[model samples]
Target chain A: MSDLSVDLGFLKLKNPILAASGTFGYGLEFEPFLDLNRLGGFVVKGLYYGPREGNPPPRLVETPSGLINAIGLQGIGVEAFIAKVLPKLQALDTAVIVNVCGASEEEYVRVVEALDAEEGIAACEINISCPNVNKDGACPAFSPESTRAVVREVKRASRRPVIVKLSPNVTNIVEIALAAQEAGADAIALVNTFLAMAIDVETRRPKLGNVLGGLSGPAIKPIALRMVYQVASRVKVPVIGMGGIWSGADVLEFMIAGARAVQVGTANLVDPDACLRILGEVEDFCRRKGIERLEDIIATVKT
Target chain B: MFKDPEARIVGKESWGDYFLLTFDSPAVSALARPGQFLMIKVSDEPYPLLRRPLGIHSRKDKTLGVFFKVAGIGTALLARKTPGETLDLLGPLGKGFNIDPCLAGKPVLAVGGGRGIAPLYFLAWELRALGASIKILYGGRTQADLPLADKLRAEGFDFACSTDDGTVGRRGLVTELMEDEIKAGGGSPPALVCACGPDPMLQAVALIARDKRLPAELSLESRMGCGFGACWGCVQRIRRDGKAEWIKICEDGPVFPAESVVWEKESP
Candidate 1:
């Protein structure tokens, strides 16, 4: 049998499959259907300083194969999450990676500082590329300077490992990845949702209430894979790949392409038990291939 | 919520390319309401990664029936199954129609078009038992498209029928038939108009209710992920203030008041 354990400097995962933020909804939501402890880890939904009701109506639109959403980062905020959501999540056996988002660099630091004080939070993933929020014209993680500054500040404020989630809507993702690595980011999660929009042609109006939305699913798989390959080759920190991963074969493809760990996002939207199914398939694939450890597959590109 | 470990396919019937599947899931039956639906994984394969959403037609004992059209690979697989087979199901989800107040000795008109009639049948049955005066208005492109006409007639419902081809009853849209009913009933209108159909049809009925000043409610359909509030996949636009607010149709409603929906010339 193949061993699926992996190490990312400060944190360790039993396997390479981790639930992406937003899709998993703080781990508690999936507890009824999924065994949270069996998988590697889960990244909770993005948190802000204050409670937010999020954007207005028509927040989501279904495309031919995927979905576009403009949810506006609606959440109960850091204080409530710590008080209510955190305690329940902490009880789970899985490693917890809280995803933090903010309108300004200072807000990011403040949220990180609050989370650092909480117990059972294994790490924090800095989301600098959420397309839903309007306070920031574009996510700060899109630019190298802003990405570095946010990473440096958060790393300075917390002792926990900070994983900077990079946006795919950029001129060169490697530049942003390298910048995060240089500024003391413990790891990097590549390819947040691509900026997109849909139209109700008959009405000549935008389908989503926000007019613009973030696209995720099988439609963006090729782009996400290419970006992961690009960033993994350029950055020294471990890379967590995401976007359109539906099965174990897709996970292996991401591992071969270069991601040390892969997160399942849109697939969870389609199948609530997708993460568990994918994890089982990965173990079966490893056993069938006679692989001894999951680390042997990371960044193992074939000519 | 307990998982239905046994993927038991309790029953199956064919309606053209569509299939009416009944599964033995005590968990789903125990929780399901009249208009809620289930997300069924037709195949364990990854090609069709998402489960197809199907409305719960009826629930009895420990079994829940789902009515679906074979529009894709998932439905096609479901149609091929026998009564003894098992299919994976996750369900009894989404907010159903509110039948309590409407059933208080009030005259209720249940309107449906095409496959949309599935959920309304259960609602009508529940209303009848509650002693509400129930009238069913069914519309289809042709007589053949009316999948449950015989079942409705057998149920002894006071019904009106219309078809686009003039094959069965009136030769216009179901709305034309509804107009006559509204005229005869005078300005008071029926106690409520409960409708479920295509988006265009629902939009038309909503407009009629607004013009006639009739109390109306509708069951809306959208592609969903979690079938619960978590994924935010099945969101619909509703006017809260002067602006629009996104609400999860699966949770807040598959049912909404007619006045709240902002219907466009096209769906946006």
Candidate 2:
């Protein structure tokens, strides 16, 4: 059997397939369907400084090969996550990472501080790409400078490794990735949903309650791959690539594009078993290619 | 917990605008309980990236039945499926009706509106086999929508129906038909009321259950992302123990105690 394990510098994974945050809830809900210990690891839904009620109803819309949602990062806050969720997640045999979102720089650092001393958390995936909530009407991930500032602060405060979740909405994503890497980010998770919107011509109403949402699915795969290639080539830190990854080939493509590991996002929504299934498919591909380990092909791209 | 397995289509039957799909899926069928649902991948294509949630209609041995209406691109694709074609389905997800907690010698009241009546058929069928008294109240916008009327009658079920246009059964809301049934029972109704349908109608029924202090349960619907608890995209405001919490409709329930639902914040 081909070795699917990979050491991502800051974190070691049994495999390279991690369930994306927001798509995996707090990780307990999928205990029935998902054997958490069997996979690489799972990231829980994004958390905030306080409980967020989220956007109004009709927060989701489906596009051709994609889904756009404005869930607005509704979470139980950092404290509650540590109290009610972490204890159980700590028992899992896989990585238990928390995706934290904030409305401001201070909010972001505060959450990092809370998780810094917390136990069982493998790392903190600082979210700055949420389209639902913006501070001063600007999404932090949109500006490379803002992205660097937030990552630097969180990296300084965080006891564990920090992964700065980047946005696909930016024009020059490479610059943003470089900024985060220079700011002391241990790693970077690319393409946190593309900013998009849908409309209902019949009622002339926006499909999502928050008007716009992050678009993810097969529709964004090509775009995400391009961005991953761009950022991975420029940034020194390990890259966590995610976007419309539905197949084993897609996972392999992301890794060859220079991602140390990949997160299965929208595919999990289509099939909760997508992660494991994709992992199986990856193993099959590696076996057929006569490759012994994923590291052999990890970012081994050719002209 | 859920499983994604390829289920072969056994048959497809149409009742007006509704399509009743039967799949020869033993595992999902065996695990089936009324009020439980499955996420059906309508097509192999990528455009409609998410699965459509459909409640189980029947489980005759290893065959599973799903009754649904064509409401969007996903359902439209589902309606086009032919017998012998295979479908990838993830199911028997979500918390179904906890009938055991309320079954104690009390009869069951199953209320539904249009396709909302779909899941209730299986629910009533189960209770009937247990020798429990079952009364079904099926409602719709008009006669064209109440196609399940004759089928419910043919099953030897106690049927009470209403149509908004007064073209069939009683005229007015389903809550009125339920009130009439309650009056016919001499003010002592069934032990439990289980309902499914559009939000407005379910809310109205929930209000009646509240006013009468009748123990009721409802199968709620929301535009779902993942038909599991992960996304928390399909959430409903519910009041429990005097506190309000947003419960994921796909996980916490497609079925919840009727009184627990708070229709005030209808949008969230």
Q: Compared with the true structure, what per-residue lDDT tens digits does model 2 show for residues B74-161?
A: 8999899999998888889888987674474567788898899888989988888767789999888899888778888998998988
What tens digits encode model 2's per-residue C-alpha lDDT throughout A138-238? 57788878888998888877789988898888789998888888899899998898788889999999987788788888889999999998888888889
DockQ of 2: 0.68
Model 2, C-alpha of A165: deviation from truth (Å): 0.7
Kindly list the per-residue Cα lDDT of model 1 for residues A262-300, writing each as its tens digit. Answer: 999977766777898898899999899899998999999
Per-residue lDDT tens digits for candidate 1, residues B1-268, read: 4346465878877778657878789877888777777777766654455567777787778887877677766678778888888877777776787778646687888888888887888788778888989899999899877878878898799888899999998898888888888897775578889888898899988888888888888888776666756666566777776776667787677888877887656443
Candidate that would win on lDDT: 2
The residue pairs that clash in candidate 2, if any, are A32-B1, A33-B1, A64-B47, A65-B46, A65-B47
Docking class of 1: acceptable
Model 2 residue B129 CA deviation (Å) reads 2.8
A-chain TM-score, model 2: 0.97
What is candidate 1's CA lDDT for residue B119?
88
- Candidate 2 C-alpha error for residue A126, in Å: 1.1
